[model samples]
Target: MKRHITGLFVLSALLTIMACKKSVEVLTPSGSDETYKVPQGNNDYDNTIVDYYNKYGTYMLYKFTEKDVYWTPTGWKKPTLPNGTWTTGAEVEASDSAYINAQLNLIKNKWFGFYTDKFLKKFLPAKIMLCKKVDSVFTNYVFTPTFTAVKGTKKVAAFYNYDNIQVNYGDATVNSMTAAEQRLFIYKVNLIFMQSIYARGLNAPTAEFANSADYNTAMTTYAQAYGKGIIIGYSNITAQSDWNAFITAMVTYSAPQLNASVAITDQTAAGILNTTKDPSGQIKRRYNMVRNYFINEYGVDLQLVGNATRGL
Candidate 1:
């Protein structure tokens, strides 16, 4: 009896060891063999929100790349490169080739005038227009309306279908030539364009547009600085009825979902920033909420804004 009892104890110990080994292996990443662990500690999301909105407002630009695409709609097969291929210089130029023609058509159609089209007529200094071929299998790209840059009687320097892009109007104080101004404009334009396209082309067009309120909030906040048109970005929300609904739910109709760890480039969140007052006096800033979530969840580093020439 004593021998048998001792044997049982030995077997149990071996089993426990095996189980622990398996657990350890499960926790290890296959490629790097690194232990995967989520970040701990609560982040000050509310503070981030107040600070972000107080400065950038809701109308800032956002860029959506392959990294931004996630949780696709039902029955919608996402692309391997959901963000689409990056356009080459040659391709970027080809896309711009038609800018002059498009502008002329818009002018002829009376779509633009001194008061009505004043926003579109601004000569974008050093503009980069990205476009995709028509009817291309570029669904994942944040595809939006074509953004073309045109000069008076000059051939369009750039025209291309982008997955998404945006254009914003600012007060004369926000000059396009300033680096900060340029960065802010480009980022906001890209984000706004993305949202717009998503609403129009996704599965549920109307719903997507309505649901993208948070996104719009960000744009609106950004727009306050410029004193003119709001943020405009591209979107592919209306590719299908279901997709539109999904995106809308994700944006306007949903609660603030937070991402802990988001990638932040050095350019955006570096150094002392010139936080602009929320000119509109609206406290809510969509971009701030989004950024807060990203930073809290992912520890994304945010930089401060300062002088434009200071190579932030």
Candidate 2:
């Protein structure tokens, strides 16, 4: 009995030791694992990219794959690169390496110079992809009397350009742009910024401003939809689209221009030549609301941004 009891004690100790060994093996992490690293060419442009990342947490990606741009929808198969042989799928080509520096300069002077550092850090997307071009293809099926046939088509759909803010930087046109053209480019980039801000529900106006009866009445009454509490003719379709148009106008036109637009008296059937006047003062009211919201909440004056870009 004593011998048997001693054997049982030895077995118990060995079992405990084995269990501890197994636990340690399971808990230990691999030391060789590393994350994806951005390439460093040790050039000025690469240094600027690194500086932007360090300052604003935004990756100025000029060299990236299509996976970085296209997002896989839920329950949908993940997309793969065509490897230079694609007939029906999405693809994105990286910007020309030579033009990367010029594009970076344009972004620095026009985009970063306009906004405060704090604003860019907070509002800019995590990745801003600069591409030469982006394209996608879809395959449609048609049924004939005898059999089913497939039709492959190539097109650039907005859906293919998913999460990141993509800028198509074509050739070295930055150096040749006139002052007015430069300002227009600035306006377009800033419009993207404002659109992203609105889409994310960050620093947006309240429902009181967005859904106001005065604004709605003015929008519905006017046919042209400009200078009457909205910015574009298509804005009359939906309140959300109207807000987008309003933001577009705020970033595109100066305060004086918009105010002048509201005061025009000559009437026309096509809503041009200052035909759509704001008699109810709703346009002015909503304009003030939008301007004030940006100023009070973000310490940003939308009119000032527009005015600066417009060279006012």
Candidate 3:
């Protein structure tokens, strides 16, 4: 997917996928006089994943959607400042927790199916609480105040503030989801995990491009074939765009699976893109950066991830 196919697919799926993602049962906030609703069943997941989560992190249930995290003893402890006010950065929810557990289970299962490496398995964030909302105050913080920046940042025997990958369960929930729903959910999780955190590390691993001439030439060739609009800001933000190109390519296995989002006017250039043709090998150069980063950094064969992700 040296092209923008995954980006396009992800964008396309967002507005519609949430509509079908199921609904959540809101619980009464703590201290409310109203009778408390019964908490949902915790989705039992893979034992290895459950053990990793229980031993390393806490699953929290909050009071509302998009509210500040106020954790209870059953969950992780909510961080308190000197003033006794809670840390204000995290978007969260509960049945939501069950749904989240299911989502995490899906991801865990996919990881086992695809990746032998434990990098993501060991570090993936599990929502510590299941609640209605989390206050949004930590926009300025490096992490959203869900978990620590790294797994061991707060490293006390299972008592550190680990970072969280916020899964806002306000709009929908997944419990015993259908195969299709699970497939789509896993796809989105993989995409977000890849773009937001996973790929960011790969951004600066290699040196910046040696020269802009080769880049410019490639852009010109690309513009001529795909139209100037496609590469309009190509030169202005090559690195960021390069990462996107890498993600797209790394996610999709081939042109056949890329759907029709990619509009290639020049059939020859399209062939070159698919590696059926390459006048100077310029098109593949950008893609190689992403592929090489994975191989060199984690010693991972990214093709395995692509194959597994694509299988879903």
- The segments of candidate 2 whose C-alpha lies over 4 angstroms from its true place after superposition are 1-36, 72-92, 133-160, 201-203, 207-220, 223-242, 262-276, 308-310
Q: What RMSD, rounded to one decimal, does every model reach?
A: 20.2, 9.6, 22.9
lDDT of 3 at 167: 41
Q: How many backbone clashes does candidate 2 have?
A: 0
What ranking of all candidate models by lDDT puts the best one first?
A: 2, 3, 1
Q: What tens digits encode model 2's per-residue C-alpha lDDT throughout 190-281?
A: 87677766656555456866676334443443434544555444333555565565556667777556555443333221222233366556
lDDT of 3 by residue, 35-119 (tens): 2222323445334334654554534333333222334334543543434344533333332433555545554574334444544
- Give all candidates' CA lDDT scores: 0.29, 0.60, 0.42
Instruction: Arrange candidates by TM-score, descending.
Output: 2, 3, 1
Give per-model TM-scores.
Answer: 0.20, 0.62, 0.47
